[model samples]
Target: MTIAAYTLAAVLNVFILFIGVRFLLQPFAAAAGYGVPATQDRAYLEIKGVRDTTFGVVGLVLLIFAGAQAEAWYMLAVALAPIGDTFIVLRHGGSKAVAFGVHLATAAVVLISSALLFLA
Candidate 1:
């Protein structure tokens, strides 16, 4: 059993749960962090909230239900998603801070998770 892998999986799962809660409870703030302002349309806000929450929950489930190695692979695959998100935010007039702070940060964390998984 690799210590780093287990540690990474556990930490990542907890963080994902936190992210899911943030999306659900503070949708606007979460959206702002995601480099997007809340839209006037409720549907769009709901979409973001639901999507983020789902991702978080699914990530957590991968760790809990699957295993550290599996979660690691999941993290690796999902890294591309945030990379894409960074560009999307930038292309859509999002500020640098939001793009880097949220999306880039997420990608880094995911990469770290992947490394840990690999070490495991």
Candidate 2:
């Protein structure tokens, strides 16, 4: 359980870091994969990239320096991003499948990681 908890948290953090880099380097494609197409304005996309990148680094820092309890709390709080994203996708006329399957599912997984970290 301990190993699983740490591993999941680490993997999620790294994956989000990768996603953030993708958003920074390929905003259009990243937005498309995020269940929303990008417009000509790149500001919002860049903001999202920075936000996600910060979150990923924060999560990793919490896990490494602050330990599982801190990481758990961080995970619990960060889950809101995906929950908001679920609505963002839905409201933006993105596919319902992507809205629920991607965003909502991510929220669920993050919540589960929080629970596991708490237990650990």
Candidate 3:
């Protein structure tokens, strides 16, 4: 259980880092995958990139140095981002499928990861 929790946490962080990089390098594509289309203003996309990258780094740092309890708390807090994203997509004229399937699903996984870390 411990190993599984740590591994999942690490993998999730790495995946988040990848997503951040993708958002930075390919804003339009990333926004499309995020269940939204990017407008001419790319600043918000860059902000999202930075936010996700920072989150990924924080999660990794907590897991590697701060241990499971800290990582658990971080995960619990960070889960709110995706939960909010679920609504953002919905309110932004994005599809319910993407809003629920992607954002909500991610929130669920993050919460589960937090629970596992807490147990560990």
Estimate the TM-score for candidate 2.
0.98
- Candidate 1 overall lDDT versus native: 0.76
Q: Which one is best on lDDT? A: 2
**Candidate maximizing TM-score:** 2
Task: Kindly report which residue stretches of model 1 are placed more than 4 angstroms away from their true locations once superposed.
Answer: none
What does candidate 3 score on TM? Answer: 0.97
Residue 56's lDDT within candidate 1 is 69
Model 1 misses residue 15 by how many Å? 2.4
lDDT of 1 by residue, 24-120 (tens): 6777777777787775565565665666567667777877788777778888887887899899899989998878988888899889878877777
Per-candidate TM-score against the hidden true structure: 0.80, 0.98, 0.97
What's the count of clashing pairs in each model shown?
A: 0, 0, 0
**Per-candidate RMSD vs. true structure?**
2.2, 0.6, 0.7
List pairs with backbone clashes in candidate 2.
none
lDDT of 3 by residue, 1-120 (tens): 999999989998988888898889998899999998987668889889989999999999999999999999999999999999999999999989999999999899999999999999
Give the better candidate number (1 or 3) by TM-score.
3
